[model samples]
Target: MEIAIIKYNAGNTQSVLFALQRLGYKAVVTDDKKILSNADKVIFPGVGNAGAAMQSLQLTGLDKLIPALTQPVLGVCVGMQLLCNYSEEANTNCLGIINTSVKKFVSATKKIPHMGWNTIYNFNSILLDGVKQHEFVYYVHSYYAALCNASIATTDYILPYSAMLQQDNFYGVQFHAEKSAKAGDKILLNFLQLT
Candidate 1:
């Protein structure tokens, strides 16, 4: 299977590639428009400021390529944020593939970067196959996509936010599925099985 992982100025590409390798799938990291367009599946994995990430994508023309993808495209963490309409991070506009906005987490007692394992619930999608309700998944992010019509699942940190989002063939996850364990693996597999 030709699984393409978007290569850009972001962190955690190696981890995502390794995760896919562990699943016995060989995924390539590339920004080539053809490779991305022809891939069986595409994974947009990242960890960094949303604005910087957008800059990198635009620099490589990936910002335009990403939104036009017709295949199953999965965005992780900040990648998910970039799929939204806008991000508060540096006041940047996103790909607008999903009509939502990303906002920083505000809490009375919780700290920023809602890191560590968190539970996701109220999700029902082919991408979430084998994932139990309220299953724990790893997370390490500060900004979150507010709940919207595209939300497939919700997670609570200081408040409820979109844990998983889907719009057409584009799917996104607010959590780090690469770092997440068994549940995360299932999510990836389910995505690959999508037609």
Candidate 2:
């Protein structure tokens, strides 16, 4: 199947590519509107600041193109955060594909960035099929999306927040599914099976 991985200023493209390779799938990393629009599925993988990422998407006109995609689209980490309406990180407005807001963790007890493995539960979509609840997934982010109507999964650091989100064909994961080992691989496989 034709898959496209949206290339922007965000990092982790190679990691995601490798993950797909292991899954026996090939994907092209591009910012070309025609290529992206023609792909059967698209992956938006990112690890960077929200403001800078948005700037890159804007430069390539992907900020507008992404939200309009007809095929299933997956957003990882900051890429997921960008799918929300707004983010407290860098005071930036996001793609607004999901009706939620990203907020900074303001806890003095727990560590920032919420690094390392964490359990995700409350699955509400087919994206988590064959994946058990409270399964550990790798995460490395300082900000989190607030629980909203689109939230399909939840994870906790200082408090509960969206671990996964889905609205129509758009799906967002706040964790690095490519790096989450078995559980992550299962999620990616499930996303690929979407039709």
Candidate 3:
């Protein structure tokens, strides 16, 4: 399979690549528009500021290219936030693929950057095929896509938020599937199996 991991200023592409390698799949990391467009599946993985990541995508015209992709596209962490119409982070406008907004976790008691393992449930799509209800997945983010019509999976930290989102051929995961171990692997494998 021709899988492509979208390379941007945001980090964590290596981890995603490594995970895919473990799954017996090889993926090319590139920001080149043509290379991304031709891939059978595209993984947009990020672990950085939303504004900066969007800036990098904009610089290479990937901001425009990404939303128009016809093939299946997967976004991880900040990559998922970028799929939204806007984000509270840096007051940035996002890819607008998913009909939702990314917001900061407002909890006076709970910690910021809701890190560590959390359970995800309410699987509403094929993306969570083998991932059982309340399965643990690694997460490290303060911002989250709100519970919207596109939310296929839900996770609770400060509140119930989108653990996974799907809109047409686009999919987004708030958790870091690469670091989530077996459950994460299943989610990644399921995404790859998508036609």
Which pairs in model 1 have colliding backbones?
none
Residue ranges of candidate 1 with Cα displaced over 4 Å = none
Candidate 2 C-alpha lDDT tens digits along 1-195 = 999999888857999999999999999998889999999999998888998899888888999999999999999999899999999988999999999999999988899979999999999999998999999999999999999999999998999999999999999999999999999999999999898
Judged by whole-model lDDT over C-alpha atoms, candidate 3 comes out at: 0.93
Off by over 4 Å in 3: none
lDDT of 1 at 160: 94
Per-residue lDDT of 6 in model 1: 93
**Reference-based lDDT, residue 133, model 1:** 95
| Model 3 TM-score, 2 decimals | 0.98
Per-model C-alpha lDDT, please? 0.91, 0.94, 0.93
Cα error, residue 98 of model 2, in Å, equals 0.3
- Provide TM-scores for the models: 0.98, 0.99, 0.98
lDDT of each residue in 61-155, candidate 1, tens digit only:
99999999999999999989999999999999999999999998888789888989999999868788778999999999989999999999999
